[model samples]
Target chain A: MAEIRKATGFIDWLDQRLAVNKFIKVMMTEYWIPKNINFLWAMGVVLMVLFMVLIVSGIFLLMYYKPDIKLAFDSVNYTIMQEVEYGWLWRHIHGVSASVIFLVIYIHMFTGIYYGSYKKGREIIWLTGMALFGMFSAEAFSGYMLPWGQMSYWAAQVITNLFGGIPFIGESLVVWIRGDFLVADATLTRFFMLHVLLLPLVILLLIAVHFYSLRVPHVNNQESEEFDFEDEAKKYLTGQKVESKVVPFWPVFLSKDFFVVGVALTIFFYLVCFHYDFAMDPINFEPANNMKTPAHIYPEWYFLWSYEVLRGFFFDIGGVAAMDIGLAAFGFANVIFMLLPFLDRNTDHVAPAHKRPLFFVWFWLLLIDMIVLTVYGKLPPTGNNAWVGFGATITFLVLFILLPIITKMEANCKCNTGGCK
Target chain B: MRELKILAVVIFFTAVVYWGVEPFAHSQMHPHVAPADFAFKDLGVNSKKGDAAKGAETFMSAGCIGCHGVSSQGMAAPMDHASASASFGVVPPDLSTAGAIYDKNFLAALIKDPTKALKVEHKFNESRPHPMIAFFGLGGDIDQEIADIVAYLQSIAPVTPMSDKQVFADACQRCHDIKYDKLMSTTDKEALKAYMGTVPPDLSMMIRSKGTEYLTTFINNPQKQLVGTSMPRVGLSEKAQNQVIAYMEKVGDSKKAEREDLGYKLIGYMVLFTLLAYAWKVKIWREVH
Candidate 1:
C-alpha cells in the first residue's frame, strides 16, 4: 500500500497493522459526492435509519409476541400493551416504521425516475433497488400476518388465493406456499421465518450492493454532463493531473445526511410516541376469525395501486378466469417496472429533470394513475370505481409502453432543433 | 460552531415535536378505539342464550314501554305517526318490525346505555339528543337483561319470514340497484342523488364486500356507524339485523367461515433471528470507532 499521508503514535501503530485510516480515508473522508444533490438524495440515509429502527423494535416485539393462533392476538393486543414494559412503544415503532419506510421508498423511487438515475451505468444500482423493493414487499406482507388480525388473515387468504388463479399447478402452488390446504400455523411459521430472517437478510445484502454500485458509478446529480469519477480517481492515483469539481463525502454530504436523519427520526419518534395508529387499519384490531371475513379485504395503502389493477379485470375471457388474467397482467406490469432500464433505451447521461421532458411527463402521469388506483382500490369495487380502475389500468400500461418511444422522439426532436449539447 | 448550533436547533425542534405536536397526533391516531377496549371479535359472542318469554318481562320492567310500543295495540305516547314524530323529532319507530331490523349486539348496547353506545359504538355526536337513557340503571347483570329484551323483541315481529331476495328487495332495492332490469328512471335517480348528496351504494355484493359485522352495526344506525351519513337511523331490532345478515350471507360470501386461521410461531422465529441479527451487527461493526 502507498503511504500518501503521515500518522503518529497509536494511529501510526494501527495504520501499520490494520490500514483502518486508509479504509476510512478512501470510503468516508476522501469519498466524493455530487454537490447539487437535493433532499431526495437524503432518503437513502433515511431508509438506512428506518431499517435500523425496524430491526431494533422488531426484536423487542418478538420477545413478547406469541406465534400461536390462539395466543397471537392476545400477545399483541394485551400482553404487549399491558404486560411488557414500554412494549407499546416498541410495537408502535415497528408497526409505524413499516409503513413510513415504504412511504420514503416511494418518494426515493419517484426521485430516481424523475432524475433518470436508472440510466446507463447505474443499471445495477437500479436493479438492486428494485430487488430490495420486491424483498421489502414480501417482508411487509409476511410481517403484516404476524399480528394474526382480521385484515392479516383475510389478506393472506386473498393474496395466496391470487396464485390459485394461475392455470394448472396453481392450487398445488398455493398449498405449497401456505404449507397446508389454507393459511394456518405452517404458513404463519414460514412467513415468520421469511419476514424476520430470510427476506431482511436478502434486503440488507441487496442494499449493500445497491450502495456499492451507486458509489462506483457516483451519485447522479442535477447536471447534464456525466462526471466520470473513476477516470479522475485513476489519474489522481497515478500522480497525474486531475480536475473535477466534487465535494467530500464527510462533512459536506455527511452533515446533510445527518440533518435529514435527525428530522426523519424526529417525525418518526413523534409518530411512535403519539400518532402510532395514523396509517393503521381499524379492522386489524379484531382477532383472526376463520368463520367471518371483514366487509372489505384491502392490502396496506402501498399495495393498493396493484390491487386496483387486479380488480379492474372483472370479466373472464373465453375459458380463463378474469382474476387469472388480472394476476398475469399485474405480474407483467411488475416485470416491466423491473426491466425499466432496458425498456428505456436512452443512452443520454442527462440527470436534469427538464432535460428529460418525456420521462418527466410520463412519470408524473404514472404517479397520478397510481394515486387514483390506490383510492379506487380502497373503495368497494362497484359503479364508478370499477370504471375508474379500468381507465387507470389502461393509462398505467400506456405510460410504460410509450416511455421508450417518447424519450427517443424527444431526443431526436432536441437534436434537430440544435438543443442537444 | 455553526454545526453545533444547527444540531442544537434540531434537538430542540425534535423535543418540541415530541412533547407538543406528538400528544395531539397520538390522540388523533387513536380516535377510533382505545387499546384498553375489548376487541370487536370478542364482542360477537353472547355468554347466555336469551329466552323470549323471560325477555318480555324484563322489557316492560326496563321502561321500554314508555317510549316504544308493540304494533298499535298497547301504547304510551299516542300511537299516531304525527304525535310520535312531534315527541321524538323523528317518529319513534314501532317495535313490531324491530325483530327484523336491529342487531342483537346493537340492541344490547342501545338498551343498556343509549347515549354512551351511540357516542362510542356508533360514533354519534355527543350533543345529539338521545331519547333512550340507561334502562338497567346503575348495574347488576345488565347483560342478561339486555339479552332478554333483545330476545323478546325478536319474538314479537317479522311474522312473515321473508326470503333473502325479498328482504334485499324491500330494504335495499329502492335506493340501490341489484339487477339492471328494475333500474330507477334517470330523473328520479338524479333527484335522489341530489337530495342525498351521494349516490347510494349497491347491495348486490354488500355482504361479500363489507363483511357481516360491518353490515350488522351499520344497519342498526347509519349515523352511529358512520357519522354525517345521510342514511337515517333505521331503528332495526336485533332480530332484524340477524335476519338481514343471514339473508345477505346466503346471497353472497357464504363461505366466509372457511377462512383459515393464523398462528404465532413467526414471533418466536423473529426473536431468534433478532438475537442472531444483533450479534451479527455487533460483530461486523466491532472494528469501527
Candidate 2:
C-alpha cells in the first residue's frame, strides 16, 4: 500500500486497529478493473444489489409468514396483506424481485457465454457461477412453496414426486426432502428453513468464491486482452506507476455501477408499482388444496426451458419411465452449460463471437430453441406441443454436442483465407 | 457535486417508483371487486325464481325423461349398462340424484351443449361422441327452459343435509371403496367392474383426489368430464350437489374458508412495506453515492 497523510479522526482511530482503510483501498478504492468493459459487465453488480433487496425484503416477510401448511397461505394472504402495515408492498417486491433477479442472471449468463467469459483461467469462476445458478433455482423453488397457494402446493408436489422417477431410493428421497409422506406442514417448514437460511448461505458462500476467482483473472473485456495482475500490483505498491489501462474501483466504476443500478431500479420499481401481478399466475391466489390440481401447472418462467426439456420425453424408453428420461435430459442440459469452459477447444485467446461465424450460428440457434421451449412448456402437453418439444430438444442437444466439432472444422477450413472459394 | 446529482436522481426515481407506480401495481394485483349492479334482486331470466309445477312440464318437454328416469330404481333408457357402453362407449349415469349432484350453472350449461359446454367451461379434454345433443337447438327461450328444469329437479329432491358418511354411501360408495374409513358396506365389486370395465376408486380420499369443482361437475355429467368413462351422469339438484360438496369439504378441506379468508389481509400489508423499504433504500444510498 502507498504511504499517505495520517488520518485525523474516527476513521484513523478505527483504521489503526481494524485495517479498514487498507481493506477499502485494496478491495474498492485502488482495485483495478478493465476500462473497456461494457454495460453487460454491470449485471453482476446489479445482481448483487438485487440479492440484497430480496434478502432484506424476505426477512421482513418472514416476520409475519406462517410456515404451517394450513395457515401459510392465510398468513401471507390475510395477516401480512391486511394486518401488517406496508406488508403487501414488501410481499409484492419480494415476489416481483424473484423474477427480476432471474432476468438479470439470464442476461449475465448470456453475456458470459457471448464473450467466452468462461474460457481458460476463469473456469473456476464459471463453475462457481453455475453452482450459484443451481442454488438460486433451488432457493426460488423452495421460497415459491412458502406461499402455500395452489400453484405453490401442486408445484411442490410435482417437483418432489419427480424424485420418485429415480428408480430405487427415489420414493424415500422424496419423503426425506418433504420431511413427510406428502407436502404437508412438515414440508413447508423444512422448505422455509432452506429458502430462508440454508440455500441463501450456500449462495452467499458461492458468490464470495465467484467474486474472488473473478478478481484474479480481472474482468474479461470485449477486446479480451491479457494483463499481469502481479506486475500491476507490484508497480502500485512500489509507488512507481500513477496510471495504466485500468480504472479505479471507486469514483469511475462505482459511479457507473450506481447509474446502472438507478436505471435498473427505475424499471424494477415501475413493474412492482404498475404490473406487479404481470408474472404471477392468478390460480396461485387460491389457497393450497391438495385434492384439486390446477389445469396447468407450470414453473416460474426462468425454469420453463428446463421444464420443457423435462416434459419433452413423453414416451417411455424400454422399461424406464419417460419422465425419468426427461429429468436426466434436463440435468444434462445444465451439465453441458457447466462444461462449456472445457468444450470450447478454440486456442485463440480473444475470438469474439461475431468473428466466429459457425459458433455464432450455433449460439443463436440454442438461444431461440430455449425461447421456443419456454413457450411450449407453458402450454398444456397437447399433441402439437409434444412434437415441438421433441424437435426443440433434439435441436438443443445437437447444437451443444456439435459445437466442438464445428469449432474444429472451422479451424481446419481455409475459407477465411479466400482460398476455398 | 457529482455525488449530489446521483443522489438526486436516486431520490427522484425512488419517488416515482413509490408514488407513481404503487397504486397501479396494487390495482393490478387486486383488481377484483363486487360489481356495482350486484344485488339481492334477480338480474336476468336465469336468476328469476321458477315454479316447480311449470318446471316439471318444461323438463318433460325438453326431452330430459328420454335419458333420465325420475326414480333411482331403474334405467329410463331401453339399453342397460352393457349395451349402452358398447354404443356410447359408456352408459350414461342415472339422474336419480341429479338434483343433489350437479351445480345449477353446470346443469344449465350442459342442457345447451353437453360436449362444448364441458370443454369450454371446465377444460374437459375427453374425446367421446356426443350422445345428448343440445335440447335448446330449437332456440326458443332456452334460459327459461333450463331455469324451469332446474326448479323441477330441485322440487323433487331438495338437498337435505346429510352426514359425510351418508353422502359417501348414497353417492360414491357403489363404485368406490373407502379404504381408510369404513363408511359404506362393500358393494358387488365384480358386477360393477364388469359394467364399468374398471373398479370404482375409493371415496376415502376422493374429495382429496379430485377437486371439489371437478367432483361436482363430474357427478352432474360424467361423460362431459371423462368422455368414455363407464360412470353415468347423476343429475343431483344444485342444493343437493352443494350439500355433497359441503360433506366433501368436511372430510377433506375443512379449513378452506379460513385459509382463503386470511389471504386478503396478508396481501394488504405487503403493499405498505414496499413503499417504506423504497424510501429507506433511497435514504441509505444517498450517502453512499
Highest-scoring model, DockQ? 2
lDDT of 1 by residue, B180-254 (tens): 123332224554465445566544345533556567667655554567666654444454456667766654333
Chain A TM-score (model 2): 0.92
Write one digit per residue (lDDT tens) for candidate 1, span A278-326. Answer: 4455567656778767756788877878888888778788988888778
- Return the lDDT, model 1, position A236: 37
Q: What DockQ results for candidate 2?
A: 0.04
Superposed Cα deviation of residue B229, candidate 1 (Å): 19
Q: For candidate 2, lDDT tens digit of each residue in B1-289?
A: 6446634743553344333223433343334333211111221225656667887778777776665556643437555645554554434555555555555655665676675544432323346345666676335576776777777776776356555455555556545664434454234555556545666654433454455656666766565456666565544455555666666555444434443454444434444544554455455434433
Global local distance difference test of model 1: 0.67
The whole-model lDDT of each prediction reads 0.67, 0.68
Chain A TM-score (model 1) = 0.92
Most accurate candidate by lDDT: 2
Model 2 error, position A4 (Å): 16
